[model samples]
Target: MIAIVTVLLAFPLGFFLHNRTSAYVVYVAIFGYSFTFQTLYLLRAWVGGDHSAFSADPEKLPLDYLAVTGAIYAVGFLLITLGHRLGAKRRNRSLAVDLESSK
Candidate 1:
């Protein structure tokens, strides 16, 4: 569901941005956390049990889910930044070689 849509969007963005590896890594991280959170949410909804002592109410959602989502978003942004830096480095090296040849 949510994981599927996230992958679909990430894949094309990766290709278009020429950062497939970073994109895939971020995608995996995002999907992994999202799935885990969703599972916990579902369990809390159905099982009516609180596995963690932090929450008094079994029906209450965990605050960690929000933290996980934020972490994923940060990872994705970092990946994009790294990918752009790598691509720029490669481009610069190629340009330097071309310039030297013309000298």
Candidate 2:
């Protein structure tokens, strides 16, 4: 669910910003971290064994889930950054050409 939303937003965000750095900051850092934290919070709640749907009282907090989320977020950031850089370079090149021709 969250993954679908994140993937759907990534391209439009990149296109809307049309700036590599800005896109990365907005999409990867901001949105990515937001979703990650939200998931963690939900997981914590469920782990507390209060939720009827997913009740589980563990002896310790799930550090492994934290590690997995961290790794997934890192990978997502890397992939998004790479794609942003490539798209930005192409768009910038075209803009430069247009500007050069206009002058």
Candidate 3:
């Protein structure tokens, strides 16, 4: 659910804004929110003496969480890049057509 919302929002911002920076801004905002939420959840579970977050191995969970977070960040970046590229291509094509028509 969160992933879907993030992708939908980010892609449109990238596409409609037609700015590379906007994609990154969206990426940073999404990544920050997700990282903070996960960290808070882990901290809460740890403080509550719930080791379920750690599963059977206490030492491995942090690494797993980091890996998953990295994957999410990477995917978000790829989506934003794709949107930005497509938007730029469209903008350029339209600009070229307008120029030709003007001439």
Candidate 4:
């Protein structure tokens, strides 16, 4: 259920920013969500007397999940940055041609 919601969010997060200039927004958001979950998980576990981090308390604080999320975020940033650069190059080329023809 959490995965489903995260996946749904990733699309717009991947799509909307569309450049390295704004890439930090997504990265920050990604880390923020992870931190928020971790904080809540720790609070709940502490309050319930679930001390051991390695214990099977079902809080789902696995390292692999963080790795996967970071990987996805990096790939998304690269793709979006590439798209922005390509679009900018194409636009500049067209504008240059227009300027040359006008001169």
- For this target, which candidate reaches the highest lDDT against the unseen true structure? 3
Output the lDDT of residue 16, model 2. Answer: 56
RMSD (Å) per prediction: 7.0, 6.3, 4.4, 6.9
Worst 10 residues of 1 by lDDT: 94-103
Per-residue error at 75 for model 2, in Å? 2.4
List the global CA lDDT of all models: 0.58, 0.62, 0.70, 0.56
Q: Is candidate 2 or candidate 4 better by lDDT?
A: 2
Give the winner by TM-score: 3 or 4.
Answer: 3
Better of 1 and 2 by lDDT: 2
In terms of TM-score, which candidate is strongest?
Answer: 3
TM-score of 4: 0.42
Error of 1 at 79 (Å): 1.5
Decide which is better by lDDT, 1 or 4.
1
Measured with C-alpha atoms, the lDDT of residue 55 in candidate 3 is 56
Off by over 4 Å in 4: 1-19, 30-61, 95-103
Q: TM-score for model 3? A: 0.67
